[model samples]
Target chain A: MTFSDITIHAMAERVITYTGYMARWQPDARERLERAAFDLFVEQGFASTTVPQIAARAGLSTRTFFRHFADKRDALFADEHAVPDQAGRIVAEAPDGITPLQIVASGFDAVAAAQFSREKSYYIARHQIIQSDDGLRERQLHTQAALVEALRSGFVQRGSDPVDALLAAHLTATVFSVSIGRWLSAESTEPLATLLRDTFDRMLRTAAS
Target chain B: MTFSDITIHAMAERVITYTGYMARWQPDARERLERAAFDLFVEQGFASTTVPQIAARAGLSTRTFFRHFADKRDALFADEHAVPDQAGRIVAEAPDGITPLQIVASGFDAVAAAQFSREKSYYIARHQIIQSDDGLRERQLHTQAALVEALRSGFVQRGSDPVDALLAAHLTATVFSVSIGRWLSAESTEPLATLLRDTFDRMLRTAAS
Candidate 1:
């Protein structure tokens, strides 16, 4: 939805008030909007929340919210797209002589390090919200499919066999998905990249057996 | 959508006309409806087809169609639910000493034997449609998720660790997915179960490397 003029001015004032906080963290408008939307989703439920409310909470105009996200749901997953993008980049740039599955595993580890390390609590809460709703689950599945596609393309571009590339991509995505679930539920303070690597190793061992 | 009374009576007559055909194959009303639905879906894209058309083509009532499928999309996937049900049953009845991943692989093999062996062309066509459409892909993902859950529950029921169960279930599903895509595309006349077994072996080898 488009922003109202009044809300735009209000958001400007709110941002000015939070200038010190912004300076400390340097979180861009998109990140701020995502955090605010997720908080509202956890508080009032995804179905009950509105874009205006998220924009207001993030201290941004509806215009600024639209500039960052197409809608509230898009805002929630703005950073999620970065995982696959980074994974693709990592795979594409890896040194020669690695197998397709090795490339995928390494890419997944890179993504976990970049995106999932610092925001443990935030991700856990978001995961809970996604798990509780069918719509969110569908969105998550779509997101995952996108990642698999990206990995498959990366493998193919690296001159791997197409069929092998597909298998490696699906395998990597499956390992990443299982690892994320375990990482979210884990009681220890182990990094997500470590958990992903361990899970990938265990999965390979089990599959081999 | 519910059935009209006129369509119901017409279906009764139509069924009588097809009595000879039905007697030969002995397919139930649900199977007939699913076949008719798929044929129509292939002829006229999934979005263009209607429920009444499927029931009419199948020599059944719209009421009977609804009894079998929730909608046109449901009709296309009538046999989809059987995979998880059969997998769960196979897992539950497996002899002792099998690992969770082994059990899941066996269950997947059983499902492919029971369901995917007979309708190669039909499944290939349906897979093409599903790959082309977002809605069908989402439904497929949901179906895959359900199978993973079923496999996970089966593992837990057999006293496997919850985290390990999840990992095994996801790995099996991923292999199954990759196998099906390859099986559908293979030019040879190999059985789906064989393809699945071979793919599982290859995936294990790749993952190990």
Candidate 2:
């Protein structure tokens, strides 16, 4: 068979898990779209999958897909745009007396319990998909950069000197980046919250020395 | 004038200071080519400028330009590839009694003295040019990631535990990245070495607290 024929054949078998006849009427249309999108992305590669294909696989219309995501890349990173805003809110809500690093800790602790605890599988799948696309990886770096900015501004608002604020934000980003990296890449069963705290503590010791 | 005419006319007037008749035969062919590339990148924008333009502007052949740099992008980041190896050497040469963080500090101090102090102007210009291009910005992130890895492995080589080594390398990278950023963005005349040292000290306090 031709390569195109092989791909079409494989797609029919692969669409079983993420699609259903009644999935169009599902309550979690967003989740359905994401599942379908991920399935299509994995089968055909990110660049080869179209939005209409993803929507059709989920038994939804393209309009519904557009409502759920601005574009295919947006579908891949539905929740990332919230990072800087969420981080800013956490920073703004903290007590007036907390250290900048402690505020960073609080943000991590919050993200882990609220986001990662229930969505570990989603993150793992997303990470794998993103690793396969340079454009997605670049978008990932932009999100990380935004997180750094969010923390940096928070530190400034808390009255740290400029240079100290810089250091604090970078430390927060580093801990988050590294812990999440280890958490996702390793087969460890440790909770992300615990891993984050442990990583921050080790960073503290290194920083102190 | 039409936009195209405006661009072509502007290019004519922009090829000054970075080109000369004897520049191709002069010492430091690499420096002359870099100066020419930077001038053209700034004048006509990086995306619009070609290798031939840069070579012609530098009074050099394309072959000579190739000898100095792999591409225009490579010209923007000539010395970056040495960072990891240089950091590794510093890590290996330090006394066994030195802390991982101290080794990091030594590496930074060495780099600041050896590279940044004398080449501050080039860095400032390079930072500006890189900021304007998404591809260049992505490459910048990649370089930063490499620096993190280099320091991480250096910490491990110095006998630190895995987590602590992660922390140490990140701290080193954070300090380096932040100090350099501040040095470039701000108008302050402080040397990079001093900024780095002070940033590290502040990080230590925050970490200790």
lDDT (Cα) of model 1: 0.78
Cα error of candidate 2 at position A43, Å: 2.6
- Which runs of model 1 end up more than 4 angstroms from their true locations? A1-28, A101-109, A186-189, B1-27, B101-109, B186-189
Misplaced by over 4 Å in model 2 are A1-30, A61-70, B1-30, B63-70
Per-candidate total of colliding backbone pairs: 0, 0
* Residue-level lDDT tens digits of model 2 in A39-141: 8887888998877778767766666778889899888777786767787889889998888888878777678776575567767877888988878999999
List, residue by residue over B1-209, the lDDT tens digit for candidate 2: 56765564455445433444456557787887888888888788899887877776776667678887889998877777677677777887888898988887776678887767556777877888898998888888788778778877877877788778877877877878878887887586888888888877788887776
lDDT of 1 by residue, B1-209 (tens): 34565665566557656654654575588888888888888998888777877877887667677877888888867767888888888889998899976776666556776877677887889988787766787788878879899889998999887767877888788778877877787575777787788877777777777
Measured by TM-score, the strongest candidate is: 2
